[model samples]
Target: MKTLSEDLMLLIEREISGQASPEELVTLNNWLSADKKNIKEYQVLQQLYRGHQTLLRNNIVNTDEAWQKVSNKIEILQNSNKKTIIYRWYYVLSAAAAIFIIVFFAWVFRINNQVVTIEAVAGNEQFLLPDSSSVSLKKGSAITYNRSFKKGRSVIVKGIAYFDVKHIVSNSFTVITNNTLIQDIGTSFLVNNTITKDEITVFSGEIKCINLSTKAVINNIIAGKKIINYSKGFVVTDFTDTNILSWKSGVLDFPDVSLTRVLEDISLHYGITVKCLPIDLSNNIYVKLHFENQPIQEVLNEIKLVTKLQLRKGNNEFIFFQSVKNESSQIKKQK
Candidate 1:
């Protein structure tokens, strides 16, 4: 079977972080209700994470220390050997199906209750619905679907979400934002609605992108490619990082695009500003740059070394500008 959706991962993260929505909270409760073992497992996981919080808070542990504690817990559970060991089946056999039901029930009850403001905060944030579709928002990202979401498969997100959607018989799964609706025929994707244009890149399968900013939708997008959105709607734009699969793989792929554009993408990915100042002389030149799974600093250095661009820090942003030599070269060529 396909692995758990990014939405599920986000849900798990939200729950652990305690950033669950009312619907999500109910979903968690419902899951706890479904199987006695689920509650037990949740309790175990909770206690384990509590140790993580304590150690980190006390400064007795660093990032590695926090993660190692969790890892140790996992290793302890796994080494117990579910099939052969008496307690093995509980952790070894796993309860993926049963856990899924927990998400389903929580969503159902929350929807029926007409929840208006189910916001996710920072930890273990997840929501389960009756349809077996789950959404886990990223930190600081918020999502809102109609309380009638179960009746009509639609959601509005303002940050990022990983969706684990159960297949519908014939309809496509849609995540609605302000200007367009991202439609997937049941695939996993990470959506950053925080973009000025609100973009969605499909990690797997196909997504039908439609812009609804006008009275009627005036644009369309396909999977494996990204649609750059303008203020009012979507315009066909190049996906510099078409190969980046935030799902399945954590790789961020940047393909052949403009340097200026690439900087914008990097800024979005890292939540920082990388802009060029006094950009000129070589405005229209397109470079084939690839930043495959590299650190931002490394990527930045690569860009600087390759393009010989000048950079300065201004207003919390790395301002980019062309060197004076490039301008002189243009002047000499004109003569």
Candidate 2:
């Protein structure tokens, strides 16, 4: 039989950090609900992690020194064994010290195995994970993991990233977002975490999408598929627009995509605010356009031309609304 997948261990770590996405929470719940044994195992591991945290909070002593002191006391006890006065107490203390020494070293070893965090600011960054997996992070994105990646591969991701996970026998690659956890079976994928939704698009292989809150897990997301976790529910849809991820190549593509989402991307990339958007056009219209490192003003001008909207700029904020016939007539006269 095959060994247990490492994804389960990664889920435990996410739970410990309180970063388990709603989907991840759901997946964990499902696992626990499946069997009482699973719950017992999870609780035991949780207890161990908490114990380690407590030990780390307090300053640890030198193991060598501690062992030496215990040894010296044991030696003194052994030499005085002929004296019946405290022979029974010496045996008890010796056993207790032996157990304490073992526990201390184990705790120290666990504390030494720490997690590493990588972040991208100002621009995109590339990272080679400890397991030889490659990660591409967009600006403002981040990932965190421990050194034992190959043995127990997992990452906590924030913002947007492209992941090319390396496959290892019996090892699992998983990414945790704000609302979902992606367990990569063997795949390359893109993950974006935004305020309204978390999306995972698979380029190749397959992945399991887990809802952390509901303990619902979907294991059928495959190549050319995208899974989205939204406020009301989740959606798994197929996408054929190859350039959907053009942001990786400095190109932005909005193909019948929501204008609000487009504006959010613009704000994120250009570091600008676009406010006072008329609610009438918020969800009724879709925009189709491509931009290649275009200036902010030029992009706004394009929106005005395409949507027949008027923009007023003040303090780096652009306010736009549908143009009135009088305003259009005035612009025509000015031209």
- The TM-scores of all predictions, comma-separated, are 0.45, 0.61
What are the C-alpha RMSDs, in order, of all predicted structures?
19.1, 8.8
lDDT of 2 by residue, 53-114 (tens): 65656645455676676666666665554565287466658766776877766764654445
Model 2 residue 306 CA deviation (Å) reads 6.2
Model 1 lDDT-worst window of ten: 326-335
Please report how far candidate 1 places residue 178 from its true position, in Å.
4.0
lDDT of each: 0.55, 0.71
* Per-residue alpha-carbon lDDT of candidate 1 for residues 89-187, written as tens digits (9 for 90 to 100): 454334434444543443343334343345666432677755678777655677654343454455657766777777684544566555455666667
Provide the lowest-lDDT 10-residue window in model 2.
326-335
Return the top candidate by lDDT.
2
- C-alpha lDDT of candidate 2 relative to the true structure: 0.71
> Relative to the unseen true structure, what is the C-alpha lDDT of residue 215 in candidate 2, on a scale of 0 to 100?
43
